[model samples]
Target: MDEFSFCDKSLSYEVRVKDLIDRMTLDEKAGQIGDTALGVPRIGLPKYEWWSEALHGVSDVGQAGNHVTHFDDVIPGATSFPTVILTSATFNQSLWKKIGQAVSTEARAMYNLGHAGLTFWSPNINVVRDPRWGRALETPGEDPFVAGRYAVNYVRGLQDVEGSTEDDEVADLDSRPLKVSACCKHYAAYDVDNWLGVDRYHFDAIVTEQDMMETFQRPFEMCVKEGDVSSVMCSYNKINGIPACADPRLLKDTIRGEWNLRGYIVSDCDSIDVMLDAQKWLNDEPYYCLDLDCGYYYPNYANTSVRMGKVKEAELDSALKNLYNVLMRLGFFDGSPKYEKLGKSDICSHENIELATEAARQGIVLLKNANQTLPLKSNKIKTIAVVGPHANATSAMIGNYAGVPCRFTSPIDGFSKYGKVKYETGCGEVFCKNESLIFPAVRAAKKADATVLVVGLDLTVEAESLDRTDLLLPGYQQQLIQQVSSQSKGPVILVIMSAGGVDISFAKDDPNIQSIIWAGYPGEEGGHAIADIVFGKANPGGRLPLTWFYTNYTDMLPLTSMRLRPIESLDYPGRTYKFYDGPTVYPFGFGLSYTNFTYKLVSSTKTVNVKLNKFQHCRDLNYTEGSYKPPCPAILIEDLKSSCGDYKVKLEIEVKNVGERDGSDVVMVYWSPPQGIAEAPIVDLVGFERVFVGGGGGSVKVGFELDVCKSLGLVDFRGYRLLPSGGGKFVIGDGVLSLPLQINFRR
Candidate 1:
């Protein structure tokens, strides 16, 4: 076999790529488009390795001593990373990139030692909408800007630079430059996907043009334009009346045409086949047995209504090509040797475990604190009751896509190292239908000095392809909290670790619940990390990645609505916080810290005027309010309109950490038209920056750029882009438009 790095050569390398493509038969080419199962041995090609899962680690098959990993609910010792939503809360781009690199590195080690290359797909880029949807943890929360920013860094970490230097972190490499190709999944308008068992195939969500672009579509654009994702996994539901796989406007025009994405597009495993069967059984129209291209049909249901054309051949070809081209780029056709057998030698190393511990520490979010009742100073606080199913379960700490962890520490194991610790399994394994333990759990709380109730959704309860039936934790989880808070003798700390958001309504109003921490499935070292935060060994800095809801499932739009609604009706689907006009239990990008931080609107118009001062003498035109739009530099062809020149948007912001301890804060900028511009949604995310503030005070400026103005042009209800419309305003804390700007449009 020959060793070749895809990065080594240029178009000259395309010769080899072309040669491989030419040698492959049509079946092989098609096979390249659709990934195969974990163990399928084809003649010329390596066995299909389609089981790579990537949240914390590869969720696919990894081997132990001499045996291959099996599909069991519980793997003895697996390291878990915080959920995607929770990690997003950190707003750490560097960490996201590192996660991508690390996940791929470990995956490569497994592949080198005889595991498959097929990865469990991850970084679900779906905008968090309707907290009730249950799978919110899989997303990067509700803001498109945040999701997009994280996507770019994550993709860069997972994928190798087509032509760049080698990373010292990744040990083994022959010629392959890319660690792994990350796929931006569930493309456009796929937030909920919460419906049970095959029902999502027929679910169509109707959204307004404004909501679609502002909320759902914005993230996909970021993933394509900035992230440079290598592949995309189509959603199960339809947008408007068409399946995502067959939607030409989304798959061809927007993703490929407007965004210029060059990656392969794969169906969500059997998603194509499922929809095909749905077109046969669900719709009253006649059924034709056609391939993905919808050509060469065989009649299935004849008598009643026999319409032949449902899916177009062109659509099928486009989808297939989308997937095939990506494989060609991956060198899947180079006839390489399959990986060999792996052993415990490839298990969690000391260094990797340390990295995992640090990651857990950085990802924890401290949501609330009243009198700074944390960081227990004395061992006199002895009676500590660790309640809730999550308190003692080793598996609860790590969320989905876990690796076999070398060390397993539960909250019970961790807290016990300090003083006396009492344990109660509050709820069963995250998803059991039982709820009788509330009274007993509360009774145990009554006997303690302080209580740490670890709770949240079980991995089995919510995940990709599986939608949750309810928003609140099932059984007596919430009731149990209410009961315990009402009866507990001491202060309470609530810790949650689901892949999705939990309704904190019960704990929010209760004065007894002193603090709330969102631990988002912090991997193997999660328990130890939680204990550290509780005991003041580590400071919690994570924030909320998505919004929280106050009520039941029906209060929000169904995930299937994208497939069921009409295209024109979609403009106002009210999916994300951007479009949702109603009040929320919690807003997007909202989170609390133990220490206090102050935000001040410092300056406005000074910076904009200063920038325009240089352009005053330009010969382009007079600098009148009607003709003073910002000009883009010639060098930045596509990125020209990134900043705003309108006099309306010149505002300055300053932040100060007034508390005694050091802490970090994410400044989120949400903008919306004042009124009557284009019937805009409530608000849209424009920009955000994360900064660390020391004990005294620190300040930074978050300016609104012109490109933000141009990008906000997705809402054109009247057909023509508004030349002179409503101006954008800045949001700080719970305050809206502490500093407002005016729009100065050019004629």
Candidate 2:
């Protein structure tokens, strides 16, 4: 191996990476594919670790393993923000972008100060398919459209500086310098976690072609092309009979061939090992360590596979090129001028905290408010009872995989300044019951003007390794809630906190439970944010990210079943809001605002006819702009790649606040498929927007222009995406407005 023009700084990324690769020995090159890498110091390459965890803030995992350098100016710990579930509840894309920016800011600050690297595994955009999935707290909720939009907005913010020169904007994604690289992870239908007889780590998910393409893999496509996500991490499970980390159909055909991810592919920790050991899909050969320093066994088998005829060396080159390409964009070899300019003070700036607070304020859903019992009038409500395990809990506010906050606020702390606050330890554990003081909690509720019952699942019951057995709150929480609700003399506001949805049907039925707040692990400012909403300092606008399933949600399907669309043969129900027709405690995309908002469709749908012969090759609908072209097989093309953008339509709608109180609502746009299409879900979310209306009066009209060919329509079993030449109705604001759907794909 010989050194080349890798540090030249003036060459194209592709050219430089190719030149750099040309100089490496096969073994030296094999060392670079895993999470951590060995340095070719002779060639000036530093030992770089590709893995960094910045889910909600700059994490300590980014710190150097050897203490090679230190960041003195940056805060010791990054600011912990609300979990993605709570963040998605906001339904505000711009806010998501700011969060991405904040996280990137902290990440860059660490990297510049030698605390971290440039590639961050963050903004987990996986669509929460099942409420039982332990990592739902890490994802953006059940709806793929919302998740995709979040992916794009977050990537945009994470990748670029807000006030850069116009030249920066003009630079196409490929040619531009990245602030930091963002990863969209555990790609395609890797949602479920273990505990109940089925383990996702070794399960073979029988995902159908339609479910695989539409529901599971859709967000990754959006992240790749729209967000230009830097890398994709394969999952721990197997799709069909193939391990995700080794599936060429998924990693190569879909990601590289069709989706044009334009970045490296990473194996989830020891995922490749599971293929050889547990799944036994790969034949046992002597396992060689990919990185001696890292001691990973499976990546070497992948290396062996590449050296032998099983995996092509060209594929290895592609993966290597993608990884090197990202490093080049980050200017790692050139010494980052961008990184140097960033300081430790950027870790948890005031602006970051402010944005997070606003996000928490908006994302905390007001699930129920009967007879307007909320926004307690301070003069009328002199005494407030805040009681529960979560009332004064710090960990309850910050969910899993978060940075340590400078200080955390609890519900009791949040409500203290609002009234004469009285707090009683109602329960000891979020999941277990140590409710010996249940009588005292009831007494406190009966004595106060209003009772804020803070109760819900925490990390112990709902995080990575702990998928709950039932939707009901664990232990005696339900019993405790009912006991306190029955005794409360005044309005009872049930505040449930969890990353995943919980069944609070009992509280919903109780007339004494006048209001319910879904404050799913609202981070550092959770207390203040909750206080703000209760005091009317901030209107509660956040909505449910995932459905609050009925207690029998477990009975609907097996935890290991990968199907998102139903199988009539087995009486299988679907996974998400789109396919699941089962009863829900609270529907996906459902939320309550203090003020009522009315929606009206103002624009008419138009029909467009395209001659099939003129457009024979259709771009894969969910794939990138000009990629994924085998063309619609039935059609012939005169101009093969010139005009695929001709299949879009626009719809406009007006929204108004009808209530006397001011509030905001997230207007969701959905598409109901033509009946009898077994592949289609009952309704799929297509688009959404957050709108604000004034107290008693205010209106705003919004328009959505959808690519009929790209976002919606029909496809063959091959996952070759193409719009149904015949169009269908696009529903706006749930069912408030519906328009005609008409598209003619004529041959």
Q: What are the models' TM-scores?
A: 0.78, 0.90
Residue-wise C-alpha lDDT for candidate 2, range 1-747, written one tens digit per residue: 234676666677778889878777777776776666776776777788777776776655443464322334445667778888899899999888888888888778777767777887776877777778888888889887788888888877787755663145544455567888888887767877785867767777778786776778888988887887877877778888877776777877788668877667776666656767888875764222111112266345556766776656565566677778888878777766656788767766788887778889999999899998878888888899998888897866878766567567677887888888899878877764576878889999999999998888887887776677778888888888889998898888998888777888888888878999989888888988998898888898888879788878787677776767776787878777877887889888888877888888788567857665632655433332443222332222224235557756788888888888888889888887544344556787777889887877688998888866555655445665555434467777558777777555556
Cα lDDT of model 1 by residue, 1-747, tens digit: 233332234433344444444554443444433344222133334544443567666665332222232323323333455667667877877788877766665555555545536344666788766555556666787777888888888777777542454343433222333446677877767765546553566677676564576567777788877777766667767777677766767776777778877665555655656566764434443122211221111112221122244544343344444443454445555422321233334446565666677667667777777678786544767878888879986765665556555567788887887657888886765663566766678888989888888888776777655677656777777776777777888888888877666667778778988888878877777788888888877666666676666555344444455422222454424545655555566666666665667777766642222132333222221122443234421111122233344323444567777877777777777665444432455666666667777766555555544453344443443222332333445566556345565443322
Which candidate gets the maximum TM-score versus the true structure? 2
lDDT of 2: 0.75
What value does the lDDT take at residue 38 in candidate 2? 72
Task: Give Cα-based local distance difference scores for all models.
Answer: 0.60, 0.75
What is the lDDT, from 0 to 100, of the residue 747 in candidate 1? 21
lDDT for 113 (candidate 2)? 69
